[model samples]
Target chain A: EVKLLQSTDVTGGTFTLLLIGMIGTAVLLFLGTGWVSRKWKLPVALAGIVAMLAAAYYWQAREVWLTAGQMPVIYRYIDWLITVPIQVLALYFFIGTVARPPTGLFWRLLVVAIVMILARYMGEVGFMHPTLGFLIGIVGWLYILGEVYFGKLGEINTKSASETVQTGFFWLRLVVTIGWAIYPLCYFIGSFAGGVDEGTLSIVYNLADFINQILFGLIILYAAAKESATAR
Target chain B: EVKLLQSTDVTGGTFTLLLIGMIGTAVLLFLGTGWVSRKWKLPVALAGIVAMLAAAYYWQAREVWLTAGQMPVIYRYIDWLITVPIQVLALYFFIGTVARPPTGLFWRLLVVAIVMILARYMGEVGFMHPTLGFLIGIVGWLYILGEVYFGKLGEINTKSASETVQTGFFWLRLVVTIGWAIYPLCYFIGSFAGGVDEGTLSIVYNLADFINQILFGLIILYAAAKESATAR
Candidate 1:
């Protein structure tokens, strides 16, 4: 059974922002679902995944909204459990659908992203020694970096015919490396170093998720839209 | 006098990564310095500021490496004090020197950036209520956004001759809007909500700083380089 230490004093702002985040994602999900080509529809599905996760967050969080003082931490992780894996898979979908990389590179990219997200979930939930899990998480991140910078993925990006793929790959890699660095840092300091309170930690995670889910989905959508236009 | 509550344990990987991040910026600084023209020198100086900041972090973080349980909180803020103004100034400089936007935009952008950073700093150090500070900071950020998206700055971008300016501005603005939402979240949670520990807070700030400093510098350098060739 899932456990929640409920606080009846929930902040209106978090709930409000969670709802706003959900609605915004929902709009994008609709764009992907309604407008995108069937040949290039996965980005929309990826956006849909985020919308659902945001909805999941809103539903779980809002249910205890009146009774809970803080949003249930477990629901946040549960959202990640399903959403994070999908998010990584979405990136893999992007690499294949847009860049159309070779098979080995494609598999490696997907594997690294999965490992990174899974390890992070385990670390956060205390299923693993948090620091060790974080280290493993870093390894997964580093592996992705290697593929983007020094591996065949880099080669594919260099030679790709799609302008969107060429341009998107650079910024996508930047977003992944620099933006995602915060998670491990959070683990190291907040979870391991006794540095932050639950409120601060949740805020950081919320902010990161908003950017990660929304901005990343938009980029995928932009690329898919570009590809669809060209295909037509 | 500077005070540090010291700990005997140090994380070698963080220290090492900080060092590497610094070195990477240093190389960019040198490239901007030695290769760029006098007309386009501010971006190089911005890179120099980041390299110096990385050095300052290394120096401060390494000093208590053997005795400190965590990285010094004050030094992190201090680094921001020195670097933030320069980063804003760099943006102004890039707009002037590269995009060659009209005169008022330069000053407006600088003023907006400075006001935003100051509000955020004051909020972080507790001179004002965190939420209030964050909102004020957001105002400044929104001003920049308005200028870039709907104001004369957008007009300037459309007319700018350099491909680098066009390409760089698109991504740079995307970065600013997306990347900066974290600060307010941190303030709201850490300061307002009474959640988050100093260590976790520091880690978030550090990761944001590294990404903010390095990636922002690279975009400026790319623009400056493009502009310099045109001027030559």
Candidate 2:
């Protein structure tokens, strides 16, 4: 009998709080982008959004800010936190591509948006079906690789020093994409073909999840750094 | 105690055969697109790839071709069937976008490519986390709606004289996305509010799955029609 494992009460509560914090941060960033875009400029505003999301993710993980299962009211909001921003960013990119926006922040924001969304969603759901999540990771990396290979990444631009500069995060994007790609390949092949035991599967899944979350955090950091450097 | 649903030892030989037949037909249509492109002088080859993937998905759910436990295998191949063509199309589109291929197939193909990939993976993995899959569906549809609103759909050249060119069985996309969205919404609200019953959850899950599969089959039919139309 395959007994369904009930999600831990503590984890569920923590999940809720993390989600609420993430969503609240996303909303603040969205508004901040609008204000900052009108004042300091768009690149700086976009950078702010990336920085805020990254900070929210870090805060969610911090023991000081978050206690396990202490808040159940926030998980539903967290789920949206992980999903809505990605969709918004992707849509923004798609529309930009068609409309030919003056600033090429579209694709960069699209990738960052997707990475953040996936990181948060994976935090919530990746453990549920490790194999499938691994597969999706491969697919996501491949999609990003295709974009980079085709020079689509260059289409995105940053407003720096009153000039539209092409400050694409080549190395950071490459590392993050490669990291996600390899992590999944290792786990899926190890478990599916090697016939690794369940214990190993669990370990690998948690490790991969942790690594993915870290990479996501790093990607955001790189995006902010790249933005600031370009501004200089 | 949640007893495991005992699966009958039904010979899935027929289902397997049907799946192969569908794959074979889809492959042929996929290949047929290449030949048609050459004959029609369509500036790009992605149209064929799209045709092929749509065919595979639409044919995937032939009632005669699936059974219990057989789904995972059927879905695995189906995933490849849809994914490979989309990736190829995306690569070509990326090249076109950067290289300035005479045809404007990049944006439209990109949309279809990503959506196809998402649909394939979501169908396979969404079963485990019904809520997550539903959320993906809503996000995807909203993205598509954004595209439609931006007139991106109209830009896709169906390569046929017909005004109403069917693109895969988007109905499956509609059903799965809508169904999954409803499931998660219900689960989150009910789980949090503590008002929904298990029986309701089970019924919603089963119904969504059934609708998703049925729509999948319909998509295959649409793919076939698309092939025939374009072939003419």
Best by lDDT: 1
Residue-by-residue lDDT tens digits, candidate 2, A3-84: 1112222232232233332332333234333222222333333433543454354344432223442222133235335533
CAPRI band of model 1?
Answer: incorrect
lDDT of 1 by residue, B1-232 (tens): 3444334322534555666787777666655665666646645655565565565456546544434545544444445544555565565566655456676776676677767766665665577765676788789878877877787767777787777777877877776677666666666677668867655665566566566776777777777777677777
Candidate 1 has a TM-score of 0.48
Number of the predicted model whose DockQ against the real structure is largest: 1
Model 2 chain B weakest lDDT span, ten residues long: B37-46
- Per-candidate DockQ values are 0.02, 0.01
